[model samples]
Target: MQNDLFPTDAESERLRYEPFHESVEILDLYEHHRSGEMDVVMRPLGENPHATPKATMDELQSAKEAWESGERATYTISSKSDGEFVGVAEQWLEWDKRRASFGMWIREPFWGRGCSSERAGTMSYVAFEWLDLDLVSVGHDPENEQSRRAIEKYVDAYCGQHDAVLRNWLPSNDFGDPTGVHVYSILQEQWRENVTTAEIATIRVGA
Candidate 1:
């Protein structure tokens, strides 16, 4: 439901990342999920807001289940200085396609600070290198320019077709706005070509 990061800051206080674990604070995630900024970023064209703490916790638990089931991979984005839950990144795999679709969302306070872009880079590395997946796909809503720009920052790394638009691809919300989704993808061969200069370093995920 969220998107991209800034790569200039390599310091720990600026950002650090780890795979989502049971130790992550559910409340912190709940707050991010319910914030007005997240609502707008994730649901500007839609309206299924998680209005309660219980619902937020349930959603987190469900995500954990999905991760454990090997259906997807999820990571917690945090600040090293305080280890705060600033965001999350995920790769939802489509086994049939041998592709993983990356998704991420940063806390409202962390927006514009490059958290999303960092996570995006990490997601690509893990999918293309660690997982040895065939392809990586990412997309954003047609009207979400912020998301568009964030995702576009990685264009050189993937360089797939930019004109692939799916009409009404996403379900309409109460507002019934344009649901066309723009998709970008990179083949495994392309990733291999870009890995040398992609600045990819593996983010360890423990069993």
Candidate 2:
């Protein structure tokens, strides 16, 4: 377990990505879901750690179904180099594009490397630029400073009040209990103002 170099494990073999470009490829992430070597995978907090279970073919199918049916977008969180699987992120919008929620997570090693922020920023960019949505939202576990710090890193990209929405709504992957979820958002007009520099930089972060 070297600190500087990425491991030679199969799960660590990832695709290549430039320093300032996005290399988000999710196929292998779904494939590498069985190895719970990373801190963040897909977990429904405040519920069963095994509630939705790990990512699988059926899970992908269900996500696809939900996307197609809901007319929303979803993607697997993949690291550029080493191709290590991280987490997943998606967007959910409501009536008239008035509001939309953004969610993302990553393995502990990849958390602060800006992948989550990258994905979150990408989600925001897409929602405002591509989908022409009205507003974008993100919810973070209160007690999870890492999650909160990640969200706050690019807080400028979003606007509106940072308030608690679902009290004990999300499953806490820790003990299988409902944990409070704090929500943040950015309006279309606000995003337009903050869209000046809306991109993430990619680098070979050590695990």
Candidate 3:
């Protein structure tokens, strides 16, 4: 059965992470994916960090297929001021559990701009308010201090709790060794209490 709570299309115009197909240029996205810096973090997560053009296209197509199948939601992050590609945001849904896990990767040059926090706010709104999911969660590689800090800030703001580290939760390197992850989650009720109306007003979702 199709889940009516899942949005077929959604975006945050003010936050700058819109629907992937609407704003992402394949070559531009591929360029970022192939960067050495990106590879260092993403490759361990099973992403083709040094992806070729064809591979990047195939991955995008695969994500589209997943979206159509009601498996996940993915968005392209761009600069609203200039429309420059900056990153990608993802939500992996577990419908039966009413939970969604979030993930993202930003370009090196765009780091420290609070893009992660904005994406977190908008996606939380989508998961709880738009999708009516019971829980939203995110995890980070233990060694990635930048991601850990960014995730902690938004999770704290949303009144989320840090769950225990899950050992061997993700691939640690290209060789497929295991690594632990720091998990955090926010319940729908917590979001209701902490996320203000003004913050929600800044996000716009499409049907």
Top model by lDDT, which number?
A: 3
Could you tell me which residue pairs clash in candidate 3?
A: none
Give the distance in Å from residue 4's predicted Cα in candidate 3 to where it truly belongs: 7.2
Backbone clash pairs for candidate 1 read 4-116, 4-117, 5-114, 5-116, 5-117, 6-114
Candidate 1's residue-wise lDDT over 105-188, tens digit each?
776678888776667666666676567789888888787888888777775555654658898888766567658888987778
Ranking of candidates on TM-score, top first: 3, 1, 2
Taking all chains together, the TM-score of candidate 1 against the true structure is 0.80
Q: What stretches of model 2 exceed 4 Å from their correct place?
A: 1-33, 38-55, 81-84, 157-160, 170-176, 197-207
Against the unseen true structure, what C-alpha lDDT does each candidate score?
Answer: 0.67, 0.54, 0.79
Superposed model 3: Cα runs more than 4 Å off: 1-14, 34-37, 40-48, 171-173
Candidate 1: residue 42 lDDT (0-100): 60
Query: Which digits, one per residue and each the tens of the lDDT, describe model 2 over residues 1-207?
Result: 112211111111232212111223234443344455432444433322222234344555555555555544455555655545566566666747566787654565664566666666566655665557777788876766777777876765455557656887765556657778888777778766665532323222222
Candidate 3 lDDT, tens digit per residue, 1-207? 334544545445445665565456688777776666676557536554755888778778877777777788888877777877777899999999999999888777788988888889888988887888999999987877888899999999988999989989775566667778999999999989999787777787766
Worst lDDT 10-window in candidate 3: 1-10
Q: Which numbered prediction scores highest in TM-score against the true structure?
A: 3
TM-score of 2: 0.67
- For model 3, the local distance difference test gives 0.79
Clashes of each: 6, 13, 0
Q: Which model, 1 or 2, shows the larger lDDT?
A: 1
